[model samples]
Target: MSATGVVNVDDARVAYRLHGRGPAVVLVNGTGGGDGHWGDLIERLARSRTVVTLDYSGAGETTDNGAPLDLPTLARQVAAVSEAVAAPHVDLVGHSLGAAIATVLAAERPELVRTLTLVAGFLTAAEPRLKLTFELWRRLIAVDREGFIQILALTTLSDKFFASPLAAHLDALAQGILTGTNWEGLARQVELDLRVDIHAEASRVRCPTLVVGCAHDQIVTRARDLCDRIPDATFSEIDAGHQAYFEASEEFAAKFLTFADGLYSPRRLSSSVS
Candidate 1:
């Protein structure tokens, strides 16, 4: 928190949390995730690698500009984070919409990213059922605020994770969400995500990639489609739902470090992904 550099991206001065010391790994949160959302994962990854968490413009710490946002707009912010942290190349991990941003970044700015991880990512929306689900998500957020959050959680979380300790932590969830959520931003995010089709965009990613999916995920169900798109991608699934980062935090963190270590072999990784 001591005098970190800020880059003005349109209306938002992107805020990035930088810590540890080693090859940089950038953690990009989902559509509604703020900087703190990656706390559990970052804490574990930081033991051996520098981790930077960022909020996309109009998402969390970044300012809200009424300007229309798409994947391209978000990718620019990823570039900003990489430059601000002085990371010549970064291992980018993105969840939900952030995963899409990471895909675009790795594809377009290949030099900025060395390895990529996509969790519960919306890659191929060709399925009729998933397309319907995506549309329903859009409408819910546009109309019912409470219903949107409830359904959103239902789609992203697995039953096991919900029944676990996190089920009783609504206070923690609410607090974390309140950090950067507003009515307008929520609506805009819904609109942007529903409209995005990252299938064609994903094929452009050439970096060694890892795609994670949840068996019971309610939100983004195109995990298999995402796995198939990347040329050299490794695909796996966790028993938990879309919020795997929290329910299976330790597991996901281990997988993250392992995959990233494989990309940068100069230093061996000691963290566990299983």
Candidate 2:
């Protein structure tokens, strides 16, 4: 079964979609992403589980008064959607910014999450490199939107991707990114990204968790740091960049499904991309 709806969260109208059936698996998107971004992964997971996706306050079909984005509020929005689903508990899969939100949720509301999977996640953006990158993003968005997207692509995608035949369609890819992006929303998310700090929450996460890192990721290089903070959390690395889910979808899905199904051993500290 498939359905779509919105959940009221403070001043925001958060949109969400449901696909397939069985155990619930909620997928949370990163900065500038929405429920729509999980199309491919949803297709793979939905075959065996009810896949849920939602747009944060500034992304996708979600809307809110122009309040500056914050981690607590964003996490609340995710919690609202999870509660709306009425599931006893759901497997939570979060990427990048979504991972931080998931960390907060898992800490504050452990009963809502059965298992947690954080991909390309980080403990905080207070690190010099991350802070500078996000600051640059804010400035670029204000002065040069096109350049901002171009730079984003360069940093998030691996060199291997650019060397592949798919590079011939770079123009189309950029155009799609340009058209699909919500500039104002993205700017707000970028602002939130700059302020993200979830170390305390990560340590409080008691649920089984998996932290997936991108070997070539230029963004969120501290994914393993997050894993170290969480008790018994397993760490895995994919041979791609920040956008590993897109660059290596099959491998990403396989790892995620294995963890979500409880087949993966938390004792295993690390796993390489197969």
Candidate 3:
């Protein structure tokens, strides 16, 4: 739940958390959110690997000491996490914009990454309507944070998430997002968000990849088209939306771990004594 450790990178102390204990996995969260956004999904994959999630430069409890927040900068900050942890050939799992960053990292550092799993991801600047959603996020953060969270609840997750049974969870999710650090860092993230395309470089990924599209995503439709862009990609479909990580946690985990395991050669670890 907390960052496993923090280290200074340039002007910012990037905080990262590690889960599980075998091969490594790094999770990237959505806009204005942090590693915690992966919810139970990270917990599930940790069953067989050393999964790492981070509080981006200013997001989560990780505070910003003032660093560049542009697209390339954000991309490298994540790269720094891989570097700091000495993760050798990682499998990256990212959701929404987090998926975008994971793809960029896979593109630039193919050697460091063994595979990539993108959930609810995209190349929005490449989409006219999707770019408008980025604008709306800017307006909300600039004018109304709570409103942003409320609607984001609608956009990222599904109507089912807001339906009577799951409605109460909204308060808890809001608290997490509101309480996290990175106010200006998040804003800077948004500014840089407007300039890039998640799809532009999808074709560049050379590692084995699995792109999962939520069959009911409300935030970015055509998640499949985005998935189709990857050259060496495999695909799966979950019956949830942006927050499918929460909605379909178990199914997502099973599929993710299986896909990730396929990327690596067999290894031997010390046997657990029963």
Candidate 4:
């Protein structure tokens, strides 16, 4: 069984759902991602733990005033949902943009986050390649929506995935992206993506951290650099593209479960959560 609710944070109505029961684990989505992106991973995790998933202001069932998005505000929204769920501490698993948000939350309120996992995360977007990519994404959405979705699919998914049988569903995938997208919200998120810099916050995160990098990720290539910045953060790699969690769900879930369960030893242990 599962329960759902909404948390009013600032000008946004953050929608969240809770599944299964055990130690709490919050899954934070990346740019343009929502509850649906979790797919089978949610079911796998929910079998032995409480999984929390939510939509940011620009995605899914969540709604917010037409204002620009910022990291602190997004992190606060996640914090609000965490508080609403009545969990004393949670294991946060964030992807791409969500990883930066999770880092901010863990740094600001270390007591609320028991562990942190960053998948395909980057420290900053000021790099020329990333900045240009997001700028192009914003512009493409305005003049060519279909082109935008097609380009997104090409960049986020691995070539290996396309060669697989799943390639037959490309049309369905594109249609889903078109209907589910909130253009205005996504544009704001893209703007946020271009300006996000969590260098300061990454150093302040005081939880057992795992940074997972994707080998063929074209979107964010600084996952290794991010892992190096955090004190004693464990680093791992997946053989997939930007959407490693979705591309290699089983492997990602196994590594996540091991880390969250405190069964894996860290390369270097700087601090411990009590």
Indicate which candidate wins on lDDT: 4
Q: What would the per-residue lDDT of candidate 1 be over residues 65-108, giving only the tens digit for each residue? A: 67777888888987887888877888889998898889988989
Q: Superpose all Cα atoms of candidate 4 onto the true structure and report the RMSD in Å to 1 decimal.
A: 2.7
TM-score, cand. 4 vs. native: 0.94
lDDT of 4 by residue, 1-274 (tens): 5999999999899999999998899999998998767767898899988999999878888999979999999999999999888999899999999999999999999999989999999999997878888998989988998999888888888999899887898899889989889888888898899998999999988788999999999888889989988887999999999998888889999999878785324742543522
Alpha-carbon local distance difference test for all models: 0.76, 0.87, 0.75, 0.89
Decoy 2 TM-score against native? 0.92
List the candidates ranked by lDDT, beginning with the highest.
4, 2, 1, 3
- Which sections of candidate 2 miss by over 4 Å? 263-274
Which residue pairs collide, candidate 3?
Answer: 4-17, 123-198
**Candidate 2 per-residue lDDT over residues 13-93, each given as its tens digit:** 999999999888898899988654553778888888898999998788898998899988988999999989989888899
In the predicted model 1, the residue pairs found to clash are: 155-218, 155-219, 156-242, 254-272, 254-273, 255-273
Q: How high is each candidate's TM-score?
A: 0.88, 0.92, 0.88, 0.94
Worst 10 residues of 1 by lDDT: 265-274
- lDDT for 167 in candidate 3 is 77
Compared with the true structure, the alpha-carbon lDDT of candidate 3 equals 0.75
Q: Backbone clashes in each candidate structure, one number apiece?
A: 6, 0, 2, 0
Off by over 4 Å in 3: 1-3, 65-68, 198-200, 265-274
Question: Candidate 4 — what's its lDDT?
Answer: 0.89
